[model samples]
Target: MTRHKLGFWILTALVVGNMVGSGIFMLPRSLSEAASPAGVILAWLATGLGVLMLALVFGSLAVRKPELSGGPQIYAKELFREGSHGSRLAGFMSTWGYWVGNIAGFVAVITTFASYLSTFFPVLTSDKVWVDTGILTLKAGNVLTFIVCSLLLWGTHAICMKGMNGAGRLNFIATATKVVGFALFIIIALFAFQKSNIGPFLAPRTNDSGETLSLLSQVNAAAVGTLWAFIGVESAMVFAARARRKQDIRRATIAGLLISIVLYVGISILTMGLLTQHQLMASQNPLVDGITAVIGPIGGKLLAALGLISLLGSTIGWVLLSAEVPFQAAKLGVFLPSFSKENGKGMPKTSLWISNAVGQVLLLSTISGSISAAFDFIIYIATLAYLVPYLIASLYHIKLIWTGETFTTRKERVTEGMIAGLAALYSLWVIIAGTADLKTFLLGIVLIVSGILFYPLLFKKGKVRGTSN
Candidate 1:
């Protein structure tokens, strides 16, 4: 049977939907807390260029190697090839890192979803309500939040199980809703913009004990905060196999990235202009808070509702992407074979369920913490996981350029090489920044090491097939 595939616009929406989720909703305050307004703008410009280069590299790979459709895993596997053991390890690690990142990302999505939902459903975000059953006690509000998150997770799984086309349509609607909602926000925010609120854009230095930071240092710090917003830029490449035209993958990736950048920078800048850095830092939901200050309480609620809808769409988009990575990798024997199994609708049933199961477990475990705390923990780890794949992919792109394997003209080659080099450097910087928190750094290391255990299973599978042959 012929399978239905996603077209250019739907693929673009997938990228946009996945990239614009929890990060943007919370990052305005985070960025303001980290740097001055000028520093924040510079950080966005730097991160934007870095991410755009990575996106372009992925798009170029889509065009140059259309048959390699599983994203980083395929890039590593093909570049390194079948005969090299180190190559196989690189391929497996790329796939594993991506899979881990997706699961962590999903947890962030659900936690953010519950957090926003709490604006309407107070119980989900309320302090833990203790319930005792003789010998045991449970946090009732936490348990309820867990149940809500689980239902959303599994419900999306069911939709995805039906087919990609159905999921894509749902994502398209969600993406459109969020984009329009944010556009309204930008328009309103601009009207509310106060010149004085920006306040000496570069921040003044006092002493070591003071809150002053150099512009360069501030930009560097802001880059780390903003990195999570762009985590799903590679979504189009991951689903390349399901694109109606291979060329659509390239177009969708670049277009989606540009759109996301504009929205991120515009909204964040306007948000800063509307609220003082001190006020923004104090705000739990900066966007909604800024809107409230301008329009009133009702406007805040409206934006909160819109934020929930946006997060819901993002969660759905990410679930599809998270499942696809391992499923596609398994098909190439880079992961356990079970992950490749699909239902009648051509969905990766086992992969989807397992990914959500992990996310569910993480969500339940973190229920004791505030939504912000849980989000911070999970997002940092997710950012760490994502950096591994990005770093490896950038390196592979550099290798291709060095080998003169990708471009036709000398100018194109030099330009592409420079871009790839800058992306590789950016990836390294982000990874270093992610590790600055020792606890998160150690936890990420442990997770990476744990993934190696599965390598033996793959090796065993290969040996059995060799004996059979």
Candidate 2:
């Protein structure tokens, strides 16, 4: 039987769904905490341009390197496929880094989902428990929340296991719901706009010595926080193999990216206008809070419902991507062979199960405490982890341009070269911004270094295959 493939619209939904996750919902508050209104706007403008360039680079690669599927991993593998051990290690690192990042992202998504659900079902947000076993005391609320998260994770897994077409259709529904919901939010915010709320737009905070931070420093500080809103801009390129028309991958990526930019900028700017920086910083769910302050409690609850829908869709999209990356890598002999196994529908059964299992472990480990704190920690690390693939892909684009591998004309080469250069520099800037916290920086380094252990196993598998063949 032939497998049903994903089409242009579904692919587009995947990009939009993955890019507009829980980050956008809470990012207004997060950004407000770090920068002034003017600084936040500057940060968005900068991040928007940089992420757009990266999206275009991915689109260019999809068009030019149609044979190289499986996202950035294939780029690393093919670029270094000269049989040197160092080259092989580089390829494996790209794949491993991407897989690890997605797993961490999955944890962050589900945790956010649980947190949003807590708005309605306060039990999920409760910290106290009836039982107190010394070794493994379980909070009733947390256990129930975990059950709900696990169900959503595996339930989406079941849909994806049916086929790409089915999964993509489900994603389209979820994406459409959230898009409409966010549109309503933008409308309400605009109607409730207050000019006074947006004043002191460049309010730079003072240090302990009473020295205010410079405008440039304030904008720089907001870059990483705003960059989170554009994390999955390359979702379409990752599933290139499943796309019915390869060109659709490029169109879908650019289209989805433009849509996300509009939504993100609109929501952030409008929410800033609706509430003062103090109000935004104090609230956990700033979108909901802004709506509530403007209209009433009903408006806030509606926005909360919308957030839940948005996060659920986003989580589903990432889960599919998380499985696809490793499955494709395993087929190319980078990951373990088990990951290559697929069900009758051509879905990566083993990879899906493994990815969700890891997510489950992370969810259980982190959900024991404050959900918000856990989410904040996971998202910061996940964001850092993602920078690796973004940087590698940008460099790969530069390499292609230098080798004239994808350039058709002098003008094309120069334009792409400039875009790739800017993208690489922007990725570096975000990575540096993410590393401002020394402890988080060290943790990221440790995670990257830990990928080394899997190399020996991959080498042993290669030798066995060589002998068998």
Model 2 Cα lDDT, one tens digit per residue, 252-353: 999999989999999999998888878887766778778888889888888889888888788889999999888877766666678878998888999999
Total clashing pairs in model 2:
0
Per-model TM-score, in order, reads: 0.92, 0.93
User: Model 2, which residues run further than 4 Å from truth?
Assistant: 1-4, 79-81, 129-141, 206-212, 463-469
Per-residue CA lDDT of model 1 for 213-269, tens digit only, reads 678777766777788889899999999878888889889999999889888988999
Candidate 1 stretches with Cα past 4 Å from truth are 1-4, 79-81, 131-140, 204-213, 461-469
The whole-model lDDT of each prediction reads 0.81, 0.81
Q: After superposition, how far is residue 30 of candidate 2 from its true place, in Å?
A: 1.5
The Cα RMSD of model 1 versus the native structure comes to 3.2
